[model samples]
Target: MTDHTINKAVLRRLLSYALDDPKKLGYAILLLLVASLADVSGPWLIQHFIDHYIARDQYPLDMVAGLALAYVALMLTAAWFRYKQSLQFNQIAISVVQRVRKQLFERMINQPLSAFDYMPTGKLVSRITNDTESIKDFYVFVIGTVLKNVVLIAVMLVVMCLLSPRLAAVVAVLLPVVMAIMVIYQRKSADAYRTMRDLLADINASMSESIQGMSLIQLMRQEQAFSQQFSVLTRRHLASQIGVMKLNGLLLRPLIDFLSGVALLSLVALFGVSGTELIGVGVLYAFISYLGRVTEPLIELTQQLSLLQQAMVASERIFGFIDARQQAYGDDTRPLASGQLACRNVSFSYDGQQSVLDGIDVELPHRGFLALVGHTGSGKSTLASLMMGFYPLTEGELTLDGRPLASLAQSVLREGIAMVQQDPHVLSDTVRENVRLGRAVSDDDIWQALEKVGLAGQIRLYDAGLDTRLGSGEANLSAGQKQLLALARVLVARPKILILDEATANIDSGTEHQIQQALQILRQDMSIVVIAHRLSTIIEADEILVLSRGQIIERGNHPQLLTQQGHYWQMYQLQQAGEHLHKLEESAGVPEAS
Candidate 1:
């Protein structure tokens, strides 16, 4: 879009946020009008004292004293009105910002999982935090400043015209020129502001990456390289700031001062030539006072315009994210009566070009354990994500108990299905809270879930037991303990279908055995799907599917697949050999190398 069109669109949207609470906006406007009226009266009052009391010298001392007292009262009243106006404006601005920030946060969280793949976490954070903060300035300062300035200028112009039409015409002529300068500054600074914002996001992203991977960077001795990269981004950001500074210096205060000087000199020359009959001393003084008042706000208005431009750029980025079409959640709310799941002719792709899963068909009976054994790129995890409704299929029919899975509401789908990943996040909270996941579950339910996962005994050793706070990174727990805790989290929900996606891939054999025992208990009631790299864990599965390059190359129970001597057989044989070698080493008293 053209700069003007984009700015206008963003400005309109920003104003709409304020319009949400029209009563507050209306009150703010009323106070502004009152303030402007009081402001305009100040100069007129000065003119009245000069013309009627000082120059005429015809009024009594008491009358002049009364007028002076009235002026003081008028000034105090105007100050009160101005104070109320600012207070009202601030309240409205804060309300708008709170609403926008809340909506932006909600939209970010509700986006599809796929959306996060291409957008960096740090950049998304910048939009929600930094960008939103910039927009806050637009509401709190820019909106109020612009409105107040316009009112002041309009009031001054009317008073000026009444005093001298010729002088008012001069100001009217210069007004457009000053505004044109502001418009030019806005257009020129747009790209610079956008670049600054982008550079800030890059810096934030880099910092987040470096912190998250600090150990990796240290191991690889790449600290200096990352530091240099960060420095370059900051330098670019600094350059953009300098560009904005130059624009502000040139167009804002200096330009307004020059125009104000020209107006004053022009007024002098007009009165000097036209004589006292055309324009009196008091009238000239009042015009000069009005001129200073009018041009001063125009100067501030220019600066506010700069802020408005930055806010518009931020608004564009924020709105762009909020406008992204999220994954659709259908209206179907039918309860899952059974754990039976089936997929027929299912095909999918991440980028819509290459196939990730092709013509796949699978079925799991109620309370059955179905395992998916596959190579690294064999689409096992992709299938699990599809089954969980994380993405829509390119071509397929997936069903839960004969109901189309794609037609189910997200809440319904989540209620019936749960997946445990290889790497699960643990929050920095009490063990009980982590398991309950903010649900209002009873202490008995949390303890039962932990007991089912075989973690209750370990937890009981701690002084605080279930209430013990887990350290950041779950440092208090072992890898196996974290996996079991994650399982406990899912168990608390009591989903009808459970998917264990390589959950034991990183744990020890003993821990795997414990998880297997837990799974044995769970499988008696829920349909289970396990995607495993270690073939030994799934040997007892009712059915096994071997996948290669997004297609199932073999399908049968573990014993039947071994009889075929296919891909599953080869994987099982390799794992068996590795285990045998390890057992031989232990029996021979060989110390395992770290």
Candidate 2:
């Protein structure tokens, strides 16, 4: 769509948010009109006092002082209106901004996992915090400054026309000039503001990446390299900001003020030429005062144009996020009760043309243990993702029990299947909370699952037991312990199907043995599908599929695959040799007793 169309759509959305609380908005509008009317009446009171009393040489102190007191009363009323209207406008802006933030947050979480493969978390965070803040500023400026100033201008113009048509005409010249400046400023600065926001997100992204990888950067001594890269992003961001600053500096308040000066000069020159016969001295005073007051709105408006551009750009990003397509799901809400899985002629691709997994078929046994072992990019992880409905299959019939896997509701799918990755994210929360993960699992169940994973004894030694918050290094669970905690989490979840994607790849032998024992017990009640790099981890699987180049090259139980002396047999032999060599190195490195 064209930028104009997009801007209109964003404005309409913002207006809707603003209008959500119509009662308050209406009250604010009423008060703005009251404030504007009262403020504009002051000039007329002065004009009356000068023209009717002072100019006529009939100075009655009672009447003049009465007019003065009335002017004060009007000013006081206007001040009160200003306060109430500003409060109402502020409340409305805050509500709209709050709604916008919440909607943006919902949009971020509603996206499918696949959407996040290309989306950066840092940019998303920038949208939620920085961009939303820009939107808030825009709302406040538009309502409190621009809107009220506009009402004041309208009242002033109407009063000016009543007093002197020619002076009002002189002031009208500034409106078109102000409008032109606004149009040009918006046109020139939209892209600059958008680019600035993008660069800010990039800076945030770079900083987030550096923070997450700080240890890796220090270990590799790439601190200087990372610093250089970060400096480049920040410099680009700074340049973008300076460009926006220049645009605002050039096209905003100063230019508008210059135009206002020209308008005021034209008004004064017109009054000078007309003289006392055509323009009364009192009329001249009111016109000059109104011109001065009018400049405030014009300058205020031009200043707000910059914020308008920013809000338009930021809102476009926010709406784009809110409008992105949601992940497809189906109407099946009945919870999946069985672990039986069937895959027939399954095929997949990331970019449509290149197949990642092709013509795969599987019939998992009831309460079975199935293993998929392959080298990198051999589609093991892809198949595991499919098992959990993480991606749509290119061509396949994948079923959980008797129902199509894709036809199940998200709740049904999540409740029925559990996936454990190699690196499980451990929350810096209590062990009980981490294990339960907001599930309704009890403390007793948490301890039981911990015991099954061989972590119960260690946890029991802690003063607070399950309530103890996990931490780093010697203060908390190591990587393997975290992996075990994740397993315990799964046990409490009680999913019908458990998919392990190298869940034990990094742990030591003793922990691996403990996990194997846990899996053996879990296999009785849950169907387990494992993708293992270590062939030894899944030697006793009911079936093993050795995948190569997006296709299964060999399939059987470990002993049967060994007898075949095929791809699976060769992989096992290689792993055995590597293990034997590592053991020899360890023995050779042992020091003699001295």
Candidate 3:
């Protein structure tokens, strides 16, 4: 995006945050206003002390003491007000950052599956954590401190002009030029820093990917190679940081030199051009002292401008995500009356160019079981996803009972369907709580489901039983045990339509048998759509559909397909032949005619 576009977007979103908590903004502005007035009073009080109390032996003890007291009082008041300002502005800063992060998080979750396929998890995380932090710095420092400087400069300039117009005119002339230089520097610095920010996000993405794949790295003996790749990213990150520092160094030094020159020249002219009597020594001293104070705000404004630029970069990334379209969840949802589902002339493709499921037609009557067998890439999972309405079909209609899939609201469809994927996710919580998964299932029901999956005895052996905590990813549970827990969770859900997308493929024989028993119980009350790899598992299925290369090549019962002597029969005979040979070898090994 263009720099102008980036700034405008950031400013718009930042203002929205300010508007969100107007009370904090109002309080911060009020405190700064009070503090600025106190800041402007300092030089006048010092001038009074020098001229009235210290000159010509005219010291009045009571007046001197009172002035000293007033000076201390103003100093204390300014400090108190500054503390209040920090507290109020800090709250505003935190709230705005949190609001932006929350919006970005929600948008990420609700995006279409296609969008997620393209963006990595780590990059999204950087936007929420690192990018939002930049915006927070701008709010607390730039907005809170910079505006106070504007007020202090205005009051000081007016007082200086009243004291001596010629001196004021010289300062006024140099002030705008100094400001113009700072503005140019700010624009350049902003662009450089934004590039640096994006590079840092890329580095984060690479690190996260490497950490998640650490096991594969070890198994392949790629530790050295992976470390080299990581070092490359680290160097790129260091270079970006150095670039930002270099940009600041170039701009800041020149701006400071110009301001310093202005101050020096103004002092020389005041001493040389003004008649000694016209400007008292005390007055001259005050003007010189206040000049130093005035430049402080100018310096602060320029430095804060750099931070504002960084925030602008961060905000663009944040809002770029938040402004994306949220997945459309329609208002109307009609629940399925009988759970009879169909896919009519359906076609789909992940990448639009190649179709995964082509012109397919299929149906499952209520409470019926349909087993699907296919070669590695033969559209089984795609068909299951289409049935769930997670992806819109490229060509044809998917319906539940008599209603179009589009007519059924996504929320309604999700509520009615439950799926057990090959790899199930387990959170860091107790076993019972993980299985409940935010639903309210009774303890009795949970135990009954576990017994059905042959896990009741295992639960009884643990000291905490159902209350025992499982680590994240269920690291505490064995792989087979985790799969059984997944089955039990799904069994308790009792969804009208159960989809097993290779659910039993990742478990041992014992767990697989338990899953079979659970599937048997499920068949009585719910329609089951299973994607299977081992043909023997589906031998007794109501009907089997065999697919190849995104198209169904055969469909029939076990006996009918074997009689046809096609692909299924050939595969079965090969397995039988291997088993018979194994049996003959075992028999020959025994003592002959013992």
Model 1 / residue 391 / CA error / Å: 0.4
Q: What's the lDDT for residue 451 in model 1?
A: 86
Candidate 2 wrongly placed segments (more than 4 Å): 1-6, 57-59, 471-475, 584-594
- Summarize candidate 3's per-residue lDDT along 130-149 as a digit string, tens digits: 99899899989998767788
RMSD of 3: 3.6
Candidate 1 clash total? 0
lDDT values for all models: 0.86, 0.86, 0.78
Give TM per candidate.
0.96, 0.94, 0.92
The residue pairs found clashing in candidate 1 are none
Candidate 2 lDDT, tens digit per residue, 154-259?
9999999999898888888888888888888777877777788888888888887789888999999999999999899889988988888887788887887788
Whose TM-score is higher: candidate 2's or candidate 3's?
2
In every candidate, how many clashes are there?
0, 0, 0
Show pairs that collide, candidate 2: none
Model 1 C-alpha lDDT per residue in residues 138-163, reported as the tens digit of each score? 87789888888899899999999998
What are the clashing pairs of model 3? none
Could you give me the TM-score of model 2 versus the true structure? 0.94
Q: lDDT score of model 1?
A: 0.86
